[model samples]
Target: MHKQLLLIGLLLLVLTVQGQNLWREGEMQVRVYVENQAQADFLKRSNMIGEPAGAFIRCYLTPDELLHIRQQGIRYEVEVDDLNKMSASMGSRGVPNGYYTVAQLHAIADSLEQNFPDICKVVHLGFATGMNELKAIKISDNVHLNENEAGILFDGGIHGDELGGPENLIRFARDLCYGYNNDAQITNLINNREIWIYYCVNPYGRKYMTRYNANGVDLNRDFGYMWNGEGNSSGPFSQPESKIYRNLMLNNQFVIHCSYHSGTEYISYPWSYRAQSTPDAQHHLMLAQMYSQSSGYTNLPYGQGYNGMYAINGSTKDFGYGALGSISWTIELSVSKQPPAAQIVPIYLKNKAAMLKMVEMAGYGIQGVVRDSITNLPIPALVFVNDFMCVTNNPVVGDFHKFLPGGSYTVKVVAAGHQTRVYENVVVQDNQATTLDVVLPRDTGRYAWRVISTHIAGNNPHDEGNTMGALGPPDNIRYSLGKNGYAIIDMCDTLKPGNGPEIKVFENDQTPENYMVMAGATPDGPWILMGHGTGNQEFELEPSGLQQARYLKIKDSGTGQSQIPDAGFDLDAISYVYRPATDTSGIIEGFTYIDWNVLIEKAPGTEIYYRDQVVYSDENAYFRFQADTGSFAMDAIWEMYGYANCPVHLSPQQHLYLNIIMEWMEPVETIAANNSITLYPNPGRDKVAIKSLTNNPLLSLLLCNAQGAVVHRIMNPQMNVDGEILLNVSTLKPGLYIVVGIDETGKSASGKLLIQ
Candidate 1:
């Protein structure tokens, strides 16, 4: 009898310990604060929102989101208890550890390493605005997982006001660590792909209880894809918080990005450029459906700006995917506020399972950014494109988007006052940056017939598109016809609409050169030239309407070194416009989300081109292109019945690395030589001086240095002269320079200036 009794006691002790361990695994150490108990009571009342159980009504609120409950004239804050916090019977610095304070939550960061311990590092991402070190413990077990993911970026709490996200992320991380050994799928994802997670993208915003970051900038809307800072200034790139993130994003090769946000429940993607249904709209919607089904979350009205929720600019999602070429999405957590610890824990557990699966479920594909052609700024707008057309409402907590199946695609970004920009056949074989910078013309395309802008400037006898007159970036110069040289130069700032009649290019006899000046109401100008011996000459009508009466220096393509002599009958007109039927360039007109096996080969470094621009491509033959910013279609210019046309298609999320093959063609090169002039030193190595006999004033001088910076200037911007204006390049370093001259009227001419 005594022996049996002792054995029973031993068995009971074992059961007691096992029971304690189970209790510990399911502990809910949380605290809530209210102005009084009234508001807390109200939250407690709503706590019965999701599901019900004993002891906890489910006040599903992260501290920040919980704070919102105060709208009823009440105040509140919430927190979760961690094991480390349970150890310090006394608060570390006024706050006890046995109780989870914000500090202890941070302390847990050191514990979680990468998915593959040997491959990545376990470290801190950055700090929040409150200066709280936002810590993360990445548990990378290469022995269990392989994480060379095309790239993955995940962040939470950009809107300090949206607190649930970060808190939920914490829960997600916690569950992953504790459940790793038991969870088979979780282990697989971590090991196979490289996943970067930043719990609390903007902690300062949360601590201060403000919607913006430390610098008062909306961290969510800072990338300059289609950025309009004055309208939506999150902060300058110089902000420490922003800089830290910017540095990471710019360097990250992650293919997909998921930013957590609250106040609404939805999975929005693409075409934030103008809040419109992109060519890939359906496709993106499909992916959102998948996320919704998997995560048990709701999808709200996405892609709507201030027009829907509020008209804002500089959103991270659009910028990340458009400018950086990363597929990005904004995951709005819950439709309701915070629940109690018991309620929150289960919800968190559920969400963790859902999101981990969602990330895994979001497949691969091509993604990129849509920036202002001139400013290189990110614009907050909807995006659309073809190949595997996709449209996602991406939130910018950090990374761009998920991995791709290694392929190519065409992307289009649209917004007001900008041209219908298109990128044809962009390829993404691996993690490569396809900095597809898009140029948007001012919004009046309706009053605007067309935009014939170019990185290339038309003739003054140098190359295909331009002379020294229209030098590209690194230098912002505008040019026109001038004396002693084919093109005259001017400053960018000083040259605006109707600001010309400033530059003069006259004949050797001081006679206003025989030139007929033609101006357009918009960029797609019906240009009229007044000179002789005209031949092949390229021209670009600005995408935006022309500042009245702008002029360009047009000298003959020149058969010889001498300026083409006028045969007296020298006046012709030419006009180029968008193929006026479908209001587009080319469209993807197909499905996105391709399978890798369909790809020709998993190579890298291939290229996609539209007209003369190399827009997209990868090593393998995977790529797509865009034509309409309004539609996600690309410029796959196909001609029929003497007119060129392109169709528009939309994309969906989860349908990444699309195998959507596009069909496109080139329009026969057409240049109507209205009228031409003359120039000397045709290919002059040292100083190929010029003398234009055209009668147009210089408006702007677009010049570029060897490093692509504008080096010289001739302010008036008019070439109503016929003499020599030596370009004093003694200050210019020895290298190739593109010198340009624009008349006060906006006529341009460019040439190559070499320095030995």
Candidate 2:
């Protein structure tokens, strides 16, 4: 009898510890400030992975921890206990009154299968770590068989206390099954797409009225992406709940995925570990906009995650995108975890359209097959259109789908050890899917440099949409102040080519400024500063212990002396010399212009006079003469349609500036014709030698500023003096200027002059 009493005492102690594991209902939760990754790391060591609050991060702390934080002089405040709440307050709004019991949910699933056997099937998707069954209701025309149709998976209740998740998913499934043939759009989506609806992922937590699973783990934070062995879970996939979903992602091809939650009305996208733009940013933004517009919920702007609500690592949405390449999204369904019972149905009805629309968009792009030419068998490959985006074919079926805006695209198919195939002028029409089947051949040549992505920062009005290979010294240059501007160049694969990593940037003219060169695998980088230099010059970025790198970000360091106002480092062309570049002439060239109106002016100026106003027409360029300070701002405004149009605003201190400046005739034209005036060593450090190619004696030469104001003049220069008439250009500031020469025969020629 004494032993039995001792066992009972131990059992009571275990129960008390279990109670302490959970956040108490109605208990106040405080958000403690974390200054940097170090402070965040401290909080993370204490199990606060998903509770990021503001600029840096926020640590949700217990009362004792809160006091410790205060004592440590850490800033903190008590906000609404988002996790803990009164049970009586739950389901108080006009929503489903009571939470679903485990048995009741199973019964509902069973009923769904029984009632809609033709289009729905209930399947048990393994079990959570707590041993609670995870269930899903799959709705499709042929629910029992696998189809080539696009697949979409929707799941909720990854957070146990967020009842809106499971309830909304359950209701959406029920509505889809019920409205299948009766509703036209529902019938269309069901027939075309395979939909999987998973409800109540954390059943043990839900059953016990807790915020975590039976093991006190947050299932949503247990994915492998950015999982740092912190938070409530021991490691990635440590919880069976996360393992089940991970398995599902690996085994099936889900084109679209959504994870539902509550506490805010938002639709969040990826890069949860760090704030970076998703690789499929455009597609994610388009679909997110569609979902938000259809549901009328707040759409977090593109390139932002969780509405900057928090910095959560190892999240479900991030895992789906970072690992599986699925276009995943997170939906914060309501302001409360559990809204009033009466509001549940209303919320379900409101989000119904978005749920259906998301699935529809999965199949609304170009879909096709990739195959082996010799064997005539399906082969997995990558499909690229619009240089920025790429989609891979399924391994089993060799099928690929790419959603794109309506336009003519040159679809390129690439596979390992295979010669890439290019299809030209493949038109993708609105609401139509274009099919293109490609068969790759064996490659016969050695590997070479291939551009993966390109990004530029500054006010460049043209050539922004061009690929890295197509960008060069002839293209429009982006000019900004100091180190405020930058560019990102990505390669097709990481390069560790033994020794001497070389990078080259081609500029339109010689303007010296220091640039910070960095290398990494991603854009939001823990960047490594590799080199710093002036002007457009070749850089060697070889550093010790750093071998493989696929991304290069260049920032203006503003270390070199500059004669041009606010002129940072400008790049016209860039290349990574991995294997001695084979071709360097694909550099695309366009007319350069500056638009003065959009310039972010530092000081007040008077509107001088206007010449051209229409975009990219005869008057696409303008000159703004600053009377207050004898400086001119030249702007090139063009209707280049799809190109990045950055308004050119030249600083007053920059003497040689033009809003729009393009050579009327090619420089080579002067060489082709005998009647030419040549300026040797165009970017002269001190003196420039000018020669008259024709027999006519040199008449007069006038040097004018960007605004046509004469800066210097010379008359009757002796022909062939010092082999060529040497002009002193050391007094002139560095910038673009005009050189006009007139002969005795009334013949005249004008050429661009560069002062360096």
lDDT per prediction? 0.40, 0.59
lDDT of 2: 0.59
Q: Tens digit of lDDT per residue, candidate 1, span 603-664?
A: 23323322223443443444555443232223221121011122234332212233433322
Residue-level error in angstroms, candidate 1, position 571:
28
Instruction: Supply candidate 2's per-residue lDDT for 341.
Output: 68
Model 2: per-residue Cα lDDT over 1-756, one tens digit each: 699998887687567644654553334446566555555545544555344323333344556666666766767677555445443244333123565666687788889999999788887788775457888888998675444567789988787767787778888888889988799999999998889988878887676555677676777777765454545666556777887887676545577888887766767787665545665777788888888888845443333573464556568887777555578878877766667767778878778888888888888667786764432334446566755435556643457776665778888776643577778899988767788877675442212122222222222223222222223223443433323445455443454433344566555465566677777754334578777766666666566234556666667674543333444566555555433221222211133432233442211121222111212323322333322122222222222211111223233344434333322222222322235556655545687777665656668887776444567889987655444678889989997666767677645555555676
Each candidate's clash count: 225, 23
- Give the Cα error of residue 742 in candidate 2, in Å: 86
Native-to-model Cα distance after best TM-score fit, residue 350 in candidate 1, in Å: 3.9
